[model samples]
Target: MRFDKYNKKTRAETEKEMIGCLIVITCALVYLGYETEWGTIRL
Candidate 1:
């Protein structure tokens, strides 16, 4: 029973980390897109 509780907690933490990573990746892509667009306009 204690092992089951520990497993559940670990899964929750892993999910949170995955979500955080996805958000960071999305933001990075958006920033890169804007930078590329501006670079083209400037050129």
Candidate 2:
């Protein structure tokens, strides 16, 4: 029973970390896209 509880807690933490990483990656992609668009307009 204790092991099961610990496993569940670990899974939840892992999921939260994964979600945070995905959000960061999405923001980075958006920033890069905007940068490229501006660069093209300037050229």
Candidate 3:
């Protein structure tokens, strides 16, 4: 009983994409966190 009639994406595929996005976001967040910390110390 899928309500999404127009989109045909499967659950596994969606989860994989979501995980990939999360990985990228996490990496960016970590990098930014470290950069800000280092920048504040260097100031």
Top candidate (TM-score): 3
- The digit string of per-residue lDDT tens for model 2 on 1-43 reads 2446557567668778889999998787776664554462211
Pairs clashing within candidate 1:
none
lDDT of 3 by residue, 1-43 (tens): 4639726888888788889999998787776664554463221
Each candidate's clash count? 0, 0, 0
* Candidate 2 error regions (>4 Å): 1-9, 34-43
lDDT of each: 0.67, 0.67, 0.69
In the range 14-41, model 1's lDDT, one tens digit per residue, is: 7788899999987877766645544622
Candidate 2: count the clashes.
Answer: 0
lDDT of 3 at 42: 22
Top candidate by lDDT? 3
- The CA lDDT at 39 in model 2 is 62
Q: Against the correct fold, how does model 3 do in TM-score?
A: 0.56
TM-score of model number 2: 0.55
